[model samples]
Target: MSIRLGLQIPNFSYGIPVADLFPAVKAQAREAEAAGFDTVLLMDHFYQLPGLGAPDEPMLEAYTALGALAQATERVQLSTLVTGNTYRNPTLLAKTITTLDVVSAGRAILGIGAGWFELEHQQLGFDFGTFTERFEKLEEALQIVVPMLHGERPTFSGKWYRTESAINEPRYRDHIPIMLGGSGEKKTFRFAARYADHLNIIADIDLLPGKLDVLRQRCAEIDRDPATLETSVLLTVILDGYGAPSDIGEARSGRAVSGSPEQVADEIKRRVLDVGIDGIILNLPTHGYTPDVITKIGEALRPLVDA
Candidate 1:
């Protein structure tokens, strides 16, 4: 999966009425594809996130939205940035992605991790367990999901998940790329070394070089080439219409940066790519879902990472 540049549509409130919601979503995706983004992503949650908006804000179900996106576009890869493992049964999640692959002609990416978002779990009736338990659940989930994505029928019983010969038919390819998104070295990095095709670093930028080194060690210990697993970082940027910044100091927090396309790209090159990360995923958080914003950001970002 050579997705060096990705666009994440995390907000659904387009200031339009409900009937025009999905039409707007499809339009942004098509524009991004034309503007040179390699992948398209959405958040996997029932409610809007805390920093973004109210709990009742409009948010589409990830798979359903991706399915609609599949019919609307031809080339851009579609996925959630990371799926919440607790939201669905492991076997069912595997089936959904495979079905997506069949529909999109093999452009689905299974981006999953230990489920976060406590309020969503409480309101939605999914169990919100301790951190260790969530990782344990993620570990068992991969046991079932990995093989099924490979078109295998294996019976496995674990404390968290049990599958009796789960088989996913009509698979578009022998493998759908699995991207594990998080910065937990003990659980997420180890799992990535073993199972993931992409590791999206979600931690602070200054600490990333150390994390990358640790990930290399994790790969080496497991007898896997560090280079085999691809990497990307998620950045929150407030883009200007033109590719220049109003003020760049607001981005010092390192995780979320604010700037125009050029400023954001320079920061990404300095912090993420120069530190040996491969790709970049941008979240506009507020001003996204507009065609011109998507096109302008992609125009500056695609070449920076592609270089």
Candidate 2:
């Protein structure tokens, strides 16, 4: 499934009442859908990211929020921007996404990555292993998850995980789309070529063309067609006159696009799509909770993706 013009709701600290938090989240999702976004994603973290807010800031559980979003909206795909593999067991992750697919009538896309963020692990009791170790775990997880999504009960044993005939029933579809997020040419790109249906490259804008070339090489090495693996970039957009922070541009130099809606669209086309990226997933970390801004951004971006 292609995520052309996807909206990622990465911020939950709306400074509103706790009880009314979800209503605000629902509004964003509904507006994104109405404004022609094809997919809506949430970050899978127990705490806010380092740059986004303080650790204690309000952050909803990702799958729980996505499930709730499944009920709140009729269209638009639902998923995490990329689930941290360290957070859950591989077989369990398979079951969880399949359950989401069932709930959303087959609108689930399993976007996963070798999870970063050490504080979450230390605080939450998950083992934060070395970088190489994390990639090993992610590869093993994919072995278990990809098969389970396709209705095969995989019985496997690995250094990090083990499963015995794991079954994921009540599937809405026989297979769910798999999306890998990251720009590591060695591990992430090779795994994407081997296992993922889509790849969400999270590199700097100037590096995208080179990343795409490496991704193509990865696919060639695996005897897979590069076109079969859809691609997208995650862009931070702070529209003009939307309470944007003064330092956002410098803070997110190669990963953000800002200005009037038209200018934002032009920047995205030039910086991302023009470089051969297939699609874009935008998150308004500073001003996303405002529904009108979401509508405007979606209106401006819809044509580019649709074209």
Candidate 3:
């Protein structure tokens, strides 16, 4: 398949006056499905970013949101952009994903990473460990989670996590794709090369080619086929009537594929051709989720893949 296009639903309540945001969330999910988007991702955050608002301001639990979206949409795959590994116990997380997969009929993608955002971690009383410790915990968590998903009784006694004979029974029909999210060369990409079925990276169009090259090298070192590891980009799109910048040059801020549909499509095509990326997860603020932008993107971009 050609590159897949997905949407990331930012969790902020962008001035949409509503007692509840669930309906808006559902509306965006429906729009993604209607727009021929491949996946719809939700953020896993307990608080709005500091300047934005309060701790409990306009946020939805990731798993709960996914379950709701499971009931809402028919085709678009649902997942978190990356769940914080420190948020839940690995065993429970495995079961949760298995349940979500079953509910979504095997359309759940588990994108996980070592939890960052020290402020949130501290406030929530989740252990905001040293960076090295967090990485170690993440590695152990994956070891436990991946095997359990495959119906294996996982046993591990790492420094961070100790589990004994924990099993996830009646695994889903298809193995849920494990997507590792991060661009750390030493530990993140290394783990992705070893275990991930897909890799999510944030990249400007300029940096993408180099990052892909590094990933390929890592894959080779691990005796893994780079091509087998599906590459995906997380992009932020700011679509206004004024149109995007005319410069078709390198991207900054790790945000690529922003602009008018034609301009965005051209950038996307370049990324696919040069870096072999198979999918893009577009991050849209609430304003950018308007039907006009969605329709324009779908009409201008879907043919590149569908054709």
Top lDDT: which candidate number?
A: 2
1-307 per-residue lDDT for model 2 (tens digits): 8899899988787888999999999999999999999999999999988767788989999999999999999999998989999999998899899999999998999999999999999999999999999999999999999999999989999999999998889788987999999979999999999999899998788899899999999999989999999999988888998776654332375787879999999989888888888899988887847769989998888889899
> What TM-score, over all chains together, does every model reach?
0.94, 0.97, 0.90
Question: Which candidate wins on TM-score?
Answer: 2
Task: Give the per-residue lDDT of model 3 (tens digit) for 188-281.
Answer: 8999999888888865666777888889999999899898888888876655464444332222355745567788788777765446777777
Model 3: runs farther than 4 Å from truth? 1-3, 17-20, 50-56, 242-252, 271-273, 286-289
The true-versus-predicted C-alpha distance at residue 141 of model 1, in Å, is 0.7
Error of 2 at 180 (Å): 0.4
In model 1, which regions exceed 4 Å deviation? 241-253
Which pairs clash inside model 1? none
Task: Write down the lDDT that model 2 would get.
Answer: 0.90
Error of 2 at 3 (Å): 0.5
